[model samples]
Target chain A: MRTEDFLRDITAIRGLSGDEGPVADFVADAFRPYCDEVWVDQMHNVIARKKGGGPKVMFAAHLDEIGLMVVNIEEDGSLRLGQVGGVDPRILPGQRVWVYGKDRLLGIIGAKAPHLLSAEERSKNYQREDLYVDLGLPPQRVREQVQIGDQVQLEHRYTALQNGRVAVKTSDDRACVAMMFEALKQLQNLRHEADLYFVATAQEEVGTRGAITSAFALDPDFAVALDVCHADTPGAPAWRTHKLDSLVASMGPFIHPVLRGKLVEVAKEQNISLQTAVVPRSTFTDADGIGEARAGVPTVLLELPLKNMHTTVETLDSKNLREGGRLLAQFAVAVNEGWEDELWT
Target chain B: MLRDTLQTLLGAYGPTGQEHLVADKVRELLSGHVDSMRTDALGNLIVEKFGAEENAKTIMISAHMDHIGLVVTDIEKEGFLRVHAVGGISPRLVAARKVVFADGTPGIVALEPNTKGKKEPEMSDLFVDIGADSREEAEKLVSIGDVAVYAPDFTALGRHKVASPAMDNRCACALLVELLMYAEGQKNTIVGVFSTQEEVGLRGARVAAYAVEPDIGLALDVTAWGDTPQTKLPAVKLGAGPAVKIMDRSMIASPYVRDKLFEAAQAAGVAVQREVLAFGGTDGGAIQLSRGGVPTGTLSIPCRYVHSANEVIDLRDMEGALKVLLQFIELA
Candidate 1:
């Protein structure tokens, strides 16, 4: 599948943390033709495996996105919100959302107008609890349509930006899912010795829950998790972020150093533009949970630099996705050859 | 025997993301009671007990084995060590507390004496004093990334209350261990999961639940009691038996599971209080949402001064919690 097409298909579905059934189904169907077997696990992680006799290798990408859940419906026809993952309350005012209730309803996150606010109220930041979704309907009708715990996704469509960049609501993960599919497509004809498992893990935005279980079940020799990292934008710190056109290889306490070294080696061998992300503790990705699962499987993180992460206007470079997918395929082949011997030492 | 095990677990140095010591102790305790026992990827010790019936519902009960502690981030001059929180240790609790490293190295967490003004100390202003005279001496005793928990000081506070460090969870671990020993001849398959890294976001419970795929999940943990003077919480108090969790920050207990627990407690003639904690989450939060969602609830032993070195729990509440859980398991 084309990167843009895959991103569009995956982002259109609402896959909130702990509620990733639709996206998992979509990924399983997309990966069916390329794999010898495809299935979804109990945690709703979509696994597609290409059988081989050698050591197993897993390429994981989380399919879930950050969103809000309806916690309470007020008498004034507004819905109280609770976050499914980390959300900046400052960015919530004047945003559009789609309430996935009994039926999809268009809503706007209501913020107090500056004209009506007192100077004291205007000076202070708004708390997430203070914000509510305004679904333009009567209180009775709104209650009938929406219930508590209904997922409210940010309403942003995929847009093709200038300079080969694409914008979406959740490029933090669905973009990486696209990259995994691209890697599988690229490796269609390659005769790799290791069994390749492509996993579209669920609930990563919450706590890497899907990766924890799936990694234990598959028991791969080594694994790689693909996700997005902070991109260097106008206001973002340059030292802490990566460029949009390059892939990021993370080195952290959770990530095995040997696996990180091998990923860097593969990037160089494939002539892919790569950046190094130094994370001291947890990478806060699926890699963190996967690396620690059952004894310990060596894990590496492959990141696509993304702009405006965890926001409605997340942007990423298309070229990075292509090159990242290429690097992943090459890494799979390298592991098939003899990456374990190096990994153990 | 139960109190002894609780003391052993609370005294052990098993910080979040590093729970091998606690897991080892739990493994030894559960060795005789369980049909089989194994540790998972996140260091969760899962002990299984098969039921007599062939087609039985699988039940999983979890209590975390990890606790909050300070990790050595950097060594300062004059033998002080800069520390970072492994979980959610408040800066307010770090000043002038005795701590011990994993290798039994004793130290005192100290802050700069307040000559400037009466202001809350930041974590950066606080350091661990290991009686070392210089940086070299401190490095020789404690290396970077070495974790140290509050020194164990299990004390009897009154007739029924007991005080200890890590009692927020070690009490629950002890409860599960006691349940395994007493709750015999269960109809449903029981899996006792001594989960790890719970203080760091319920990491171990998530995977352990997924691997077990239990029909019903119960978390054994401590809940904050609101009986202290001028406290702004609900009317939960120590010695009130086990708290049947209604809701908390992480999850709302399944109504069916909550009702079943109430029924079990009533049948056992044990008093159970309802808990609606305003903050803090337990392993039940992860277990309830695991897989397609297992019906989950928590049995909270009402604790005072939770997440502190001097956490207190009533022994009667612990005994009541065990009785209710045993009745529930036997009826299952």
Candidate 2:
């Protein structure tokens, strides 16, 4: 698949963490053709196994996306949104969104008008309870249309800018799903010893939940996590974000130190540009849960640097997405040859 | 044997991080019985007995060794020790109770006792009295950084129930040890984990479950019994045998596991009852969500006065629980 085509397919998948069945189905359909078999576990984690004659190597990418769940439907037709993952309220207001109600109800995150606000009121941090999503419909119509526990995401167009950067919704991790699919297609005919488990995990945004259960079931010699990372952008926190040229790997809280080093070595051998995502505590990825699942499976988190994370305009380079995929495939092939000795030693 | 084991374990002055004494005692007891054993990074006791089949799927059975205690946060001029409860402690049950430090020094938790028509004092309003005149004298015996727990004292109660400070979970730990003794040359592999910090967010179980990644996990812990006068009748009671946890706030017991446990109970002719806890969570929640997930369940011994100094349980329930568990693992 072309890089843009892969990116497009990922952006097309609409999975919001806790509700990941649909995206898992989509991932299974694409993954089944390239592997021997595909199955999903209870956590809605999709596992596609490409069997070889040696030890197993499992690679995981979360299929879930961070968005909003409708906690309550207010009487005035406005929707109260509860964060499925972490949603900054500062960025939520005034943004256009698609509320996946009983029907496709279009809405906007409404903020109190600045004209009506006192200077002191404007200075205070706004709580999610103080705001609601406004659909341009009467209360009765909205009541018939939307319901509690509906999913919502920012409805944004996937656009390509002049410098090959693309922007869209749910790109934080759907981008990784696309990359894994393309990588599997590329590795279909390769002669390898280790059984390759390509898993698209679920509920990762809420917690590294699916990965914990899925990784334990697989019990591979090694694991590689393909997900999204923070890319340097204008007004982005300088310390947290990194340059796009470098391949970003998760650092603390989750990444197994040896596994992280091995992936870094693979990136170096392939001459792939690399960077480090210093997650001092937890990386809000599948790695945190997967690392400690079933005794202790060594895990490495590989990230595709993206800009405007959790926003409608989540942007990334099409080339970077493909690079992330290639890096994962290379890491797998390296493991297929011999990675266990190093892992154990 | 169970009572002696409990006495040895409880008598050892070990609280949370200073569990070396208890671990050493456990190692001595299980030395020749298990095939291999090792202490993990987080201070959990991992004892393993291999199955007949090579590389048979691993099963981890966890029981925590940690107990609730006090950490001295501050020491006043008059030698009163201000403490923070390390794990869950009822402020009402704490006042005037005797305590033992890790060094075996004895003291009393001196707090304002609740009187008629008076509310119980919170933990902050309480202090530990070690009978020292000055802070300088108290420092010689127990330092401000020291930790202590309610002193060990086991008493046989009505109808086979035994009450003790750490019986809330130490009963489960005893059962695991008993299972190990009876599990000689078992067909399937068993990883016995005497986990740490179960009283605090099931932290040790979380790590141990993730590491072992069993096809199935069964947490052996104590559950609340409402058999007493203050509690509702026909609820979990002492001597009701092992309570098969059907559901708890933390996890929904997988049907596969629930059936297995039921079958084991029926086949062994052991008394069994269903338990659906309204509140509180267990290591089952941690194991249920462990990699991709495992079919997780729990077997809880019914205990009265949980999270208190003197948790009470019937030894008959422990025996019944062991029978069901051994039968389950024999065919597992």
Q: Which predicted model would earn the best DockQ? A: 2
Candidate 2 DockQ, CA atoms: 0.17
- Give the candidate number with the greatest lDDT: 1
Error of 2 at B240 (Å): 31
Q: Sort candidate 2 into its docking category.
A: incorrect
The fraction of correct interface contacts reproduced by each prediction comes to 0.00, 0.37
Residue B256 in candidate 2, Cα distance off native in Å: 14
Model 1 complex DockQ against the native: 0.07
Off by over 4 Å in 2: A1-3, A72-77, A98-104, A135-150, A235-239, A249-271, A276-284, A293-295, A342-345, B1-79, B88-199, B203-284, B291-332
Q: Write one digit per residue (lDDT tens) for candidate 1, span B185-246.
A: 78878899999999989999999998999989999999987788876353477997898876
TM-score for the first chain of model 1? 0.97
